[model samples]
Target: MHRLLFMGTPDFSVPILRMLHEEGYTIVGVVTQPDRPVGRKRVLTPPPVKAEALRLGLPVIQPEKLRGSSELEEIKALAPDLIVTAAFGQILPKALLEVPKLGCINVHASLLPAYRGGAPIHQAVMDGCTETGVTIMYMAEKLDAGDIISQANETILPTDDTGMMFEKLSRTGENLLKETLPSILEGTNERIPQDEELVTFAKNISREQERIDWTRPGMDIHNQVRGLSPWPTAYTTFGDENVKIWKTEAMQTDSEGKPGEIIELTKEHILVKSGDDTAVAITELQPSGKKRMTASVFLNGTGSQWEKGDLFL
Candidate 1:
């Protein structure tokens, strides 16, 4: 078995590490980001990959910064035959990249030359892309700019959110990596360079990006809500409180009110006008300091405070 070093930091990376272990790959060491302070209580939490590695009895390293760290030296001492990274969250230095005998490779969420930054899956869904896929490629100095080793496609359903797409792409990447690694080690797999002209980036999502723009077309608002669901979710202000919109649908009715105006309200939906003269039906949401709930449930409790003609600012 080839000695391997695995570097990753999230739930998406866990499947690949588990699959590799199940298939009898010799994962000599695992490197993940340092534990982060998470949530309302500010609890220090380990990365998903680190937790999984411990469960598997694999050796682990948590480096605050990869460059010029003794952790890099420890990784080099492992003398890995291959290094595999998936959503590792940091760029590898040249010294570390060159240490592995068969070279470093990455399992990226998008087809190369497109969506090549930190948040590809979310960006694709936000852009209303019809299809997206996984790309296994060599690790270059630049961000996700490596030559491709293998690629696999998946359809983007109209209802797919960032969380759903993450699950789908993580599994696809796991299977693709398993099938491709042997050929890669034997030097039989092809590496195709990406076209610079076609390159596009999926920049990290910002607080501004997560705010719902009610003035946009209804479908665009729908896509924004879907793409960000379940994490750093799409939000809007309702009076003095922020409400996270977890699910919405674009309606084809002609708007009888201005953008952001509440055109219709029921126990099950809140229909609001958009800049394009249509509306979006919000079906699920989380009010500030509240748990997520169906629109009907929320309406049953707070409906008395909302009336048609009210606006979500």
Candidate 2:
């Protein structure tokens, strides 16, 4: 049995850890980020990976900083044959990377050389890519710029949002990791270099990135909404409050109105004009201090406030 050190922090990483444990991998230690204060109460909460590790009875460590930390020394003492990281949320130090005999492997969400950062799954959907995949790669010092050991591609459906893609990619990554591990141990895995020219990045989505620019093309706005759905959602200003748009569809009609102008409002949709004579029909939204609601439900309660010719900034 090969000794392994698993490092990850989010719910996305939980399934992979579970799969490895169920398969009887000797997970000598699990390293994750520390508990974070969440929600209105600001209660400290453990990450999903930490919760899962506890359930599995795996030894766990939550290091504030890996470089020059006592936890790093503890991990080195574990003498893991391999180190696997999935969305660990921090870069591993070169010293720790060298500790694993079989070397470090990362299960990245995007196909190598493209969408190579923390938010690849969201980037693929926002950019309207027809396909994206998981990449098992040898960990390099640079961010996700590693030699690929294996990959598994997935199709991006028209209706797939960031939430949907996350679920799909999680399963895809789990299977690919399992399939590639034996070859990695046997030193038979192919390490194909990525084409630097084809590389693209998916940097972390900030609050600014989540703000909807109504001046953009309708499809672009639609993609932005879906990409950020059920998260730091795409938002536009309405009166004195922020209105988070959770679902939208691009309309190809010739709607002539100022950008951000509400051209039409019905029980089912709130059509907003955009640049290039295009429009976006918002189906789900959340006003500031309110829960997410369907367009119809919101209209029933606030119909008088939302009218045609109103502008959303």
Candidate 3:
């Protein structure tokens, strides 16, 4: 069995690591991002990958940065035959990349030559892509500009959020990598260079991206809400309060009003006009300093006094 250095972080990487271990690969070590504070209480926490690696008895390293660190030297000492990384959160250093005999490959969350960079899954959903997939490719000095080894597609459902797509693509990536490794190890894998002319980048999500713009079409706002849901949700202002929206639906009615004006209020929805002359129903949200709640619940409680014609800033 070849000695593999497995590098990844977060829940999306856990399944692939487990598959490698269960399949009898000799993983020299598991490298992930360092533990950090999480949640309102600020409890220190290990990434999901590190937690799983420890449970599987794999050696784990959490370097804050890989470039010019002793950790890179330590990694070279492992003498790995191949390095496999998925969301490892750092580009590989040149010295470390040279350590692997079979070269390093990455399990990227998007199809090659498109959506390359951090936050591929989020960007795809936010951009309303109807399809996305995983790409197993050789890591290059440039970011995600790698030669493809294999690829697999997963449909992006209308209701699928970034969180859901992460789970779907993670499992898809794990299975795809498992199927590709034998070819890779035997040196029979296909190496297909990406089309530079078709390249597109999915850079990390910005705070600006998390703000809702009522001036957009209803479906666009719906896309924005779901793309950021279940983490760093889309936020807006309502009656002097900051509100994070977790769920919304683009209505099919002919509603018309100023963008952000409340067009209707039902027991289950808070329908507001959109810039496109349609309406969007906000179904779930979290007011500042409050837990997420269904619109129905908010309607009978903190939002009971809200009425139609009221505008959301």
| Full-model lDDT for every candidate | 0.93, 0.92, 0.93
Off by over 4 Å in 2: none
> Which ten-residue region of model 3 has the weakest summed lDDT?
249-258
**TM per model?**
0.98, 0.98, 0.98
TM-score of 3: 0.98
Q: Report the lDDT tens digits of candidate 2 across residue range 1-313.
A: 8899999998889999999999888899999999999988999999999999999999999999999999999989999999999999999999998898899999999998999889998889989888999999999899888799999999989899999988899999999999999899888999999999999999999999998888898898999989897786899998888998999988887768889999999889999998866699999998888888999999999655788999999
lDDT of 3 by residue, 125-202 (tens): 999999999999999899999899999999999999999999999999999999999999999999999999999999
Flag the better candidate by lDDT, 1 or 2: 1
User: After superposing candidate 3, which stretches have Cα over 4 Å from the reference?
Assistant: none
- Residue-level lDDT of model 1, residues 31-68, one tens digit each, is 99999999899999999999999999999999999899
Each model's total of backbone clashes: 0, 0, 0
